[model samples]
Target: RFPRNVQLCVLSFLLPSDLAAFASTCKRLVSLCRRDQRLWFSMCHRRWGSQTLINKWGSGRISYRRLYRILDEYKNLIGFWRRCGDSAAPASSSPPPVFFEWGPSYIAGSRVFPSKNKGYDAMIEKPFLWMSVAWNRKAMNYLDSDGKFVLNEEDLIGESGFVENELIRVNVGKNKITYN
Candidate 1:
């Protein structure tokens, strides 16, 4: 039989669905796969370690497995996106291109604009929205007003200003963005 460490290593490589199948094979593996912190932590770290601090995701209150699921669901939001729709505003008033990037505990969407410094190919980013996994494992999104991400509950304007649970839907395969 493989050592526990070796078994964990193997299990970490499997996708969540595959891991679930492996766990269903026997009771011992079910216990190991569901209860072992190391395995889930390893899976989360391996996937998103370079992008964000996996430990900071759920503030240590939730399991790494839940964190993995949350990040996996929202992984497609970590790239550049442009607004596509008819705007009543004039062409000059059109929204800027948005760049979504991973933060320590949230995915932040920023408005990308050419840098004020001339002759340099640098772009400036201003935070526009922040998305995070709430304590209940539901996705939460906060709109940034005044060019800063909301830090406190009081900073939220109203229901119309921010969305919860179903904020935005992204079709990565088709490069489409739908607001819900």
Candidate 2:
């Protein structure tokens, strides 16, 4: 077996999925590569170029491995959401009215306003990098940066008026497509 430094240097070039698979190969490698603080820090830095955000998320004694797992899991979920349907066609037979909130960069909700386009064309115009797009027949929900579905919550103990989503739209387009 190579030294710890060599293993870390090699693992730095691997994607998170590849590194996960490598760890499964043996127990010793798992203990070595998975827990290497420097290796995980490097991976996180390479994946996201913001050290301040990383430090904040990694606060409260959270290890770099755990932070990486959280970010990787979110990315995997988005990938799965994207691959669930064909993008060539519209995500649904009819586009549902989408909500775009311009606020402190942490709110998710859909609002119905008059559109300039005729006949009420439905599309999600701009999606922040930290948000996820999901939809059901009744509504399209954009999850927050923490991967939680954003919605207004009324005071409990009475009939809460929030509706749970029945299905997630698989073919939501990231941006509008204008054919020539």
RMSD to the true structure for each prediction, in A, is 5.9, 11.7
In order, the Cα lDDT scores of the candidates are 0.73, 0.46
Clash pairs of candidate 1?
Answer: none
lDDT of 2 at 120: 65
Best by lDDT: 1
Error of 2 at 117 (Å): 18
User: Candidate 2: minimum summed lDDT over ten consecutive residues — where?
Assistant: 153-162
Clashing pairs in 2: none
Error of 1 at 158 (Å): 21
lDDT of 2 by residue, 1-180 (tens): 788788788898888789889999999878767778889877866775342245434222467777666556434322212224455656664333444332221122342334566556743333322222111111122222233343433311111122324213322334431211
Question: Which residue runs of candidate 2 sit more than 4 Å off their true CA positions?
Answer: 1-3, 24-26, 50-52, 58-60, 76-180
Off by over 4 Å in 1: 90-92, 148-180
Per-model TM-score versus the true fold: 0.75, 0.39
Q: How many steric overlaps are in each model, in order?
A: 0, 0
